[model samples]
Target: MTATERPDVRPANPHFSSGPCAKRPGWTVKNLENALVGRSHRSKPGKARLVEAIEKTRSVLGVPADYRIGIVPASDTGAVEMALWSMLGARGVDMLAWESFGEGWVTDVVKQLKLKDARILKAPYGELPNLADVNFDNDVVFTWNGTTSGVRVPNGNWIADDRKGLTICDATSAAFAQDLAWPKLDVVTFSWQKVLGGEAAHGVLILSPRAVERLESYTPAWPMPKIFRMTKGGKLNEGIFKGETINTPSMICVEDYLDALNWADSIGGLKSLIGRADANTAVIAEWVGRTPWADFLAKELDTRSNTSVCLKIVDERVTALSEEDQVAFAKKIADLLDKEGVANDIAGYRDAPAGLRIWAGATVETTDMRALMPWLDWAFAEAIASLKAAA
Candidate 1:
């Protein structure tokens, strides 16, 4: 194939990175034209909007009725930190890390918090550690979906129904697109930048009745930062959970989130949202099945993430290169897509294996995913040709 005419069928929207992903299909600046940007977040209108975001999120995600949901300062990281700093150390901890984000949590618990009773269960990218090895009697901290590795725990069956301690989950990449087993989770956190495709800089923190109890009953020996503090007088700050955030929040982002939630509601709520992601993933999965040179990094169909779908180049021409050359080749494929205006930021994460990562959350249309496939093949060919020319 000589350098030929670009595919006429381009993705309508090619803004697919893993996070801060493509916004809702019809999103526009006008959607947020009425946001209370200059007003204080505590004002009646501002607070009402925030509360509406929380409620809409609850409705879309099907979070349990009793779970307490709140808006927090940082993205998903902030929400997880608050849960860890406010409610770890009363018991031993089991940290499961399959990729970068999960490993960060392990570092915090084992090295930063210096929890002597902590146990780390780790696996390389594209695989999950043995869920059965975890002792649910001890506090468990894990990511529901490994955004970097493209692997996720299949389900909550491994988590004991009657566990002794809390289950802290970093679900930034999973919520909304995947059904969370709320009964098995004590603390769940996600950023607005993920599946909903809202703006970044804020996180939603949901706590089960058990997680709140832990927060109220325990205090860590480490000094909790101002941002991580979730308790007042050793009791849960009920106001925060009711939409009174601990600090100022970007009203614009809140309004954007509301717009996204409304869009999600227009399409049939959670069940429909999950179906969208599944269909988008199926497009890529189908392509991978037929593409001779590429395969999903996630080997197990059950564990492959529907949102952050990672793929590896398996052609001998690409893989026979040195490690550094392999990464360069992967980058060239992604960069070729970018140069053609068919994709952007599709490169694998720095800490992840050399591959391509495409965001297939509900916000992304399956037609766009289908359109992107031919471009991916074109880019792969161009990248390999360039490498041969260079050699």
Candidate 2:
């Protein structure tokens, strides 16, 4: 096939960005008609809506009975910052980095807080640090999924069951689509706009009993911002966990999340969500297996993320070019797909190595994924022909 030849079919829905990802199949603005737009989030009805979101999340994800789940301000970043700022000083900390977001957290711990006892465990993109070497005696901070690199920890088995310190996980991209080991994680944070495909700017913060205990006992050396404050007068602010937000929230976003959660429940909850994502990833994996030009960025099968499936161009014609040309080549393919309206926002993250990043979360239909495969092939062939013509 040449640049002039195109695929016969295009993805039914082309909203495949890794964040603010594709909405649940059949999602519509009309579904959000009941959003409490004019009402205060703290109002009786509004808080009930918020509580419903929380309880439904717990019920769907199987979060423990003892864990406290709260709707926090900002996205996953805010939830992570709250945990890092409020919980790290009490013990030595180990920070892990394999991708952009993980590197950002490393900067927060080492540069922002300037924790003297911080130990950094890092790996190049597409790889994971040695999980067995992690020091459980020190509070550990890591991303459950490396969104930029499409890598993830295989499971929570590496985390010690009886660790002395907390495990704070930034799980924005992993929630719903992946199984999170709740007991192994003391503090886990995710945003509404990730796998569930809800609106952005709101984060969910889940805390185990151990995490709450740390909040009650340990205070950070730096001053806590109003939004990061989870405790008051040395006791956990129980209301936050019960739908009383620390700051005003957008009721519309809340309503959107509620709709997504209800959709998740209706579709057989977490098991179905995971199966859908797995099926979507399998579509890409099979395509990559047969395609000569592409390969997964993740080095290992177990570590590859089902949500953010990153791929690198391996065609010698492209890889033989200068680094800048390689990036341009990858961008050309992404642009071609976008222009064809078969895919959108499929380019690799800016800081990540130049490649393709597809969101194969539960919300994205596998049929759409199967349809998008040929478009990718067409786009790559078009890019290669353009490259030859330019030469």
Candidate with top lDDT is: 2
How well is each residue in 337-388 modelled by candidate 1, as lDDT tens digits? 8887889999999988899999999999999999999888888878877887
**Candidate 1: how large is its RMSD?**
1.2
> Model 2, which residues run further than 4 Å from truth?
1-4
Error of 2 at 84 (Å): 0.2
Clashes of each: 0, 0
Q: What is the lDDT of candidate 2?
A: 0.93
User: Taking the tens digit of each residue's C-alpha lDDT, what string does model 2 give over 1-391?
Assistant: 4435777877899988999999888899999999998888888999999999999999999999999999999999999999999999999999999999999999988899999999999999999999988999999999999999999999999999989999999999999999999889999999989999999999999999999999999888898889899998999999999999989998989989999999999999999999999999999999999989999999999999999999999988988999888888889989988887889999999999889999999999998999999888888888888888988
